[model samples]
Target: MSSSSSSSFIIRIFIICGTIFNLSHQIKTIDALQPMKSSSLFIVFGRPGSGKTTVANKAFESLSLDNNKNNKHQQCIELDLDVCISQEMKDNFGRGIYPSLKERNVFASGACDYVEKQLDEKLLKCQQQKQQQKDFNLSAIISFSFVNTDLRDIFRERFPKAEWILIDTTEEECTKRINEREGHFYKGDTPDKKKKEEEVDTTTNEEKDMSDWEFNPVTFPHIILDGNDPIEDNANNVVKEILGKNEEI
Candidate 1:
């Protein structure tokens, strides 16, 4: 072969070897930087229109700060069952009956169950996959209504390792806020209508004075924040609590 042709062949071989070596090195670097375990799960529970989404967003922001500051690439997932249920209801029942649909109220029960089950399955799969890879970091944040202790217990049983945060807001305040918020499932005169419906005597089947659902304390391991308080302050307090920092205004 000619000298110039031989030199060109050698250069081509060197380029191919260099490319393979660089690719292998990159794969090792990525594997080393990946998280080593599943991320933590956070469940934020509150009544309808009690600023659950607002608080969850704020909490995620604060957690992101911690993750960034620590140089940890942890994953955070916020799943709100209300939005899911509302969208499902709208799809099935249309907008009109959505106001008075007893089925919609029961839908929350079923949707929450479905979501919790799905989350459990996904978490298990993630853990198994990570076990193979020898590195996995995954977590979840679920926000839903905590009107019933049974429901909260079900969540605990489903995700035994999850961190629970319950936002306790008075029924009166929730109703008022719901009324003020437009385009919400519980917005407008629907709040007053719900109050009236709750007052109807089940046995007598007679409409009585207006009443709202009572705010019951959730029985779970949780950090409770008063929803009636300022949103920003309450959210900051939640961040502090989660990070084991001193609670400040």
Candidate 2:
């Protein structure tokens, strides 16, 4: 072959290689730009008396409203594991009975174990559903009692893709809120009120005597927010972070 023809052939091969490389880069960029298709699973974790439930509810409401307003194809579900377990305990025991925080601690620990098992089952169900429908997504916001580092590590290992948000509230504030809400347990019954009044003495002491639960973040990447912050604002900030709207907020 002529030297000029050989040079031209080499040039043509180089152009083809460049085009393939450019196309691959563009594909990667496109994937990055695309909205994440995987359903986002979030765990709202904190100690008892923190605003985990409140924040979870706020996020649930916001997501529900957004879905209705925009007719978005995504679905968000909030699963309050504590509430579910508490109700189950209540039903098993009897009606018109309340568990003390200490009793609740025992209940929550066991309930969390059960909830985790249920989550595994649900994941399997979701996998089967996904095989039939490509657009089907299952998202969950869960609130749980996070006591030790080991539990945190387990959660991190189990749900590596999910986001964890910790509600950080001062002990004093949590106690105050708990005290205010305790009134609802008695309602307008006089005997119930008297019983509750007597219980307050012990409850106050219990609250004051409670130890601080420390959060060590050696295992999971978590975003911590002030529990005292307005629920609406906190929810919005969380949503923004989850959607990658604003960083370092």
Candidate 3:
């Protein structure tokens, strides 16, 4: 080959190699600038007496066991809104204070505020560790009766990426469960009366209580489990989903 042609071929190869190197470096730099996500928050919610507490407790236990088995640095934590609210009432009013049904929402709002503060602190610590290039992973499972869009929005705004699980049950089943409940104050609004209709069915008090409680398809999508299912089965399903999400991190 002529010297002129050989020189042109060598110059083309050099240009191609240099372009590839520059692109690779740019990709690496972009990746390094992105922060690592080391935290996961899971919200378990449903109507009152939907068996959310039982399933959430069992799921938390399973996740804790899995974390221990894997020797993961990630901490698994469970937060029950009812328990927190009860503690707050006891601390303020006294141990004998019957959780007032009328004041429940007020107390619940306060409890949510407390949890939000605690979460903010935990996230701040995670961020500090992240800046140092150290891992500080956390997994929190929260149980609550997020009966309305407003209540659910509190967490949705805080943790946009949070995963949600819903325990779904019929209104009749929920009333039956509430009737049998011994400790909780929220007995169904009309525990004794059963409403029926001859032609057009009207909304009952149970329906009214659950009027605003709905799963938003767009704003709040969730993994749903049957409330009638055995606790063990529901718990296993939750744990499976949680593990699957964690794997993505």
Task: Return the top candidate by TM-score.
Answer: 3
Backbone clashes in model 1, listed as residue pairs: 37-136, 37-137, 38-138, 39-138
- Deviation in angstroms for 172 in model 3? 0.7
lDDT of each residue in 84-174, candidate 1, tens digit only: 5656655432222232224434655676566666555655554445432323344566777655544556556656776777677877887
lDDT of 2 by residue, 1-249 (tens): 999999999999999999999999999865544434355667887755677888888888887787558633445667776554554544422332344446555655665566555555555554544421334344567776565555555556556677788888776776566556653222222454346556736445555333323444435567888888898888886666554521211
Best by lDDT: 3
Q: How does each model score on TM-score?
A: 0.57, 0.53, 0.61
Q: How does model 1 score by TM-score?
A: 0.57
Instruction: Name the lDDT value of residue 16 in candidate 3.
Output: 100
Which 10-residue window of candidate 3 scores lowest in summed lDDT?
190-199
- Which stretches of model 3 miss by more than 4 angstroms? 1-38, 84-109, 120-136, 190-219
Score residue 231 of candidate 1 by CA lDDT: 77
TM-score of 3: 0.61
Clashes of each: 4, 0, 0
lDDT for 10 in candidate 2 is: 100
- lDDT of the structure predicted as candidate 1: 0.60
Which wins on TM-score, candidate 1 or candidate 2? 1
Q: Model-by-model lDDT, in order?
A: 0.60, 0.61, 0.69
